[model samples]
Target: KKKVMADTNVFLDRLLNYDKENMKESTVEKMQPYIKDKNFRPEQVKQVSSALVGLCQWVIAIEKFYRVNKVVKPKKETLGIADAEFNAAMADLNVKKAELKAVDDRLALLQQTLDESNTKKQNLEDEFSNTEKKLTRATKLMAGLGGEKSRYTMQSESLGEVYSRILGDVVLSAGMIAYLGPFTSNYRQELTEGWQSLCKKDNIPGSERYVMANFMGDPVK
Candidate 1:
């Protein structure tokens, strides 16, 4: 309101100055030509001049007010709009930063999980390698054991064959002794010599030596 009043004062001052500068020459000189023919009355000319001055003053007041105040308002409104846009842009940036942080966190978790999986895979591979090595050694040991078993089996069979031959020889010799001893006492020396020779040829221990050591001093029964 104070500024409006100040502009009104300035407008009134301009109007008065304009009227003063033209008071001598413009108003009267312009009216003189028409006044000579009495086409305009004195009272009517005064009213017209007053109306024109008032109209010009009013127009100047309005135009000055518009020029002065025009500089003050739109800049504030544009600044407000700019501030709003800046705040919105900042908010969007903050949201994007939060989203990026979340993505980084998720990526970190995934990397950790992948590292754990790789460690587990490496452990499993090592275990499998160790198992394979153990299995190979076990297979080799089994093969060696099978060879030993086969050799032992062959030795056992050879022993069995030798035992069977020795048993047969003993039975035959015992039968010969039983049949010859009672009826051929005079031929005993000759028969013992022949038995010794047979034992030597067969690569067997002498049964005659055992018999003489144990049974010669005892009854047959």
Candidate 2:
């Protein structure tokens, strides 16, 4: 996810600037926060997150093993045990400790990198969210400022916009999911339509995927 932000930003820059040759979906993910924005596609973000999670788990395990190994010490030298036995334990523990120490160091570096990456990702998500809200509010506020175009009601707007209009909608949604469980029993078509209307063809599917929607019609929902 940390890499996701840098890579996605680079990709977006390239896309907006028309650097088409190297912009590859297989290599990146357009973070979920920007799924509704025409500037990015979420499939790229899903790919990167899935790949990085496996790598992160692998590195975390290596770190744990190293920490466990560091606590081990050579057997007592004064033991009446066989000379060969002492030699074997000393040799084995030394090599294992060294190898584990190296792994531990590597893990520490990776962890630092991951932390920095997460911070950047979080920043990007916040920016993406806030930008969406501002745009939505501006749109709605603009409509109300003029004539009765407000009659063109949407159950919702682009995620960026909808979130802006509904204060704490995202936070509330998180609460609903975490505390109340899945919002399966009661669903609204207008909600579905509003989301659909807001989403461009490229990004809609990605946002819909985060929630397991039992769609009524075309699977596109």
Models, CA RMSD each: 16.8, 56.2
Error of 2 at 70 (Å): 42
Candidate 2 has a TM-score of 0.29
The backbone clash count of each candidate, in order, is 0, 4
Query: lDDT scores for all predictions?
Result: 0.65, 0.53
Candidate 1 pairs with clashing backbones: none
Q: Tens digits of per-residue lDDT for model 1 on 70-157?
A: 5655787799999999999999999999999999999999999999999999999999999999999999999999999999999999
lDDT of 2: 0.53
What digit string (tens of lDDT, one per residue) describes model 2 on residues 1-221? Answer: 56745686685564356433333443224322343344333344445576445334433443444445444323323344567787899999999999999999999999999999999999999999999999999999887765544444343344446444333334334444565453454553344434444443424332333233321225864
Q: How accurate is candidate 1 locally (lDDT)?
A: 0.65
TM-scores for every predicted model: 0.41, 0.29
